[model samples]
Target: MKRNIVIATLTAAALATGGTVAAFAAGDDETATQRQSSAGTQVVADRDDADDRADDVNDDADDADDREDDADDRTAVATGDVDVTAAEAIAAALKSVPGTAVSADLDDEDDSGKVVWDVDVLGGDTWHSITIDPATGKVLGSHTEQEDDTAQVRAALKGSSVTAAEAAQAAAAKGAVTSVDLDDDGGSRAWDVETRATGKADQDWQVDLNSGKVTTDRSDDDED
Candidate 1:
């Protein structure tokens, strides 16, 4: 029961790291956190009940999605001089904040009038959103969000043998990475990568975060 809750929490954290949070909120909302906390408690209470556990996990995931959506809406557009690639941006973010580089993208801010790499990292119990100068690879700014599931995220990442950079390299074989998110695959955690290769269709790959294995590979063009 405890293990299940930990897994579920880590999974939610990974999925909620990227732009997905924008559809819901810009950052961690109090209501979303409360709801997730309640769901986690419910999971433990209903450990013996499979249906209840499943429902709780689903509810938790829904709340997480809402938060992620909110974040996505708040994320700025990627634009400007992009000399540094997404992979390089991830490297810079990881150096600044040691943990999982869950997501990264080019962001063009009208106010700043500068192109920046917006990267989200999960380190220990804190979620860090860092801004990097795409041209110089300099960390321009950053913010942190501490949530109830921080420990779970830390555990999941520390337990994983594969680093985010390693996962990106494995996925890079597909194409230039657009985004990389730590994701849960039916209790197994992996890095979800989207790549764009010149003269080829975009692709999605899943690399096992625990074993540095490419578990799933497919082309996005096929869906079209």
Candidate 2:
């Protein structure tokens, strides 16, 4: 009876040891699987972050390229076969002419492919209409009007009783006097003066030469 009891106790001990070993092995396998899953998740997240960064860099590069393209387009539009700097240079050159006021007008082309600037100038007795080439700064054409005479212009002055000499002096104070003419309208004599000012806005004067009185003075306004 004693031997059987000892044998039964040993058998129970062996069974318990085997069960513990099996449980430990199963736990180890589960832990290893969980670790592999976590590592895989981290790798995928890293890859996604890298891709996002790369996309941002590509977007920035694309934006830079677009800006460069826009700048190139603007440069092309501003400058053609005719140099814009040259046009400005021509305008500057015209400002140096004596008894010539020069103003820039809308640039237009003629049949000869020349760009012209319409300038208004005041001479002793008339308003001189002038056209100049923007590229060459050369006078293309100029004309004087009889109605722009200074003596007649002085008669038209705003003041009630200003002399022709005073009107002429006033106009001259503002610009360069090119010529002065006398016109006799029956008993009334008028003086016509033409002048040129800087920046070319019109400054001619007309006055009564006989009485030294201004009969008509049109300085600021130009008829032609």
Candidate 3:
């Protein structure tokens, strides 16, 4: 009977300490929740860091592409035999002729080993070919076959349905025009155009004055 009484007294003491045990358990649960929240925050931060790294990679690729394009532009400027760009050469030629520039090409064949820009201009009813030194942007000389070629062009236009401007536009499809001339292709009339390239020889394009058909010629010989 005495032992049972002692055991009952201990059970009473434990019941009186109920709030302390519950407080300790609540504190432990709160700590565990805080640790879980910290881990979740760390995971979010890691995802953000990953996203930032991917963006950096894309930015680097874009920068590389821009650099490559700039290098290509520089290479194109350096490959020309003349120091002047095609635009500058054309502008100088137009200042001398005051006409619509049809074509401009670098000609490295001067006897003095100097490079010149051969520009063709269409002004009024005549076509003018002006040569300019690329280094100085100075006019070297100019010539025109207007008297002879104009008469033939007029005669051909009288019989053809297509206009001169249209024929030139058709021929320009082959490439940039270096020179344009009117000539007889067998019995039919045609417009012969030479197209300029950066590193290659001028290409020949023929536009049929009557049909407005454009054709290419592989030969280096002039159609005249």
- Mark the regions of model 2 whose C-alpha exceeds 4 Å error after superposition: 74-224
lDDT value for model 1: 0.71
Per-residue lDDT of 41 in model 1: 93
Candidate 1 residue 81 C-alpha distance from true site, Å: 4.3
lDDT of 3 by residue, 52-147 (tens): 999999999989866665344334345553465445666777888876555565554343444466777766678888897766778889987454
For each candidate, what is the lDDT?
0.71, 0.51, 0.65
**Number of backbone-clashing residue pairs for each candidate, in the order shown:** 23, 40, 0
Q: What is the lDDT of residue 112 in candidate 3?
A: 41
lDDT of 1 by residue, 40-142 (tens): 9998777768877788999999898666543332232223245676789989988999977767765454334445678888876679999988778899988
**On lDDT, who's better, 1 or 2?**
1
- State the TM-score for model 1: 0.53
- The window of 10 residues in a row where model 3 has the poorest summed lDDT is 69-78
Better structure of 1 and 3 per TM-score: 1
Clashing pairs in 3: none
Q: Distance from true position, residue 31, model 2, in Å?
A: 0.5
The alpha-carbon deviation from the true structure for residue 137 of candidate 2, after best TM-score superposition, in angstroms, is 23
Looking at model 1, residue 148 earns an lDDT score of 66
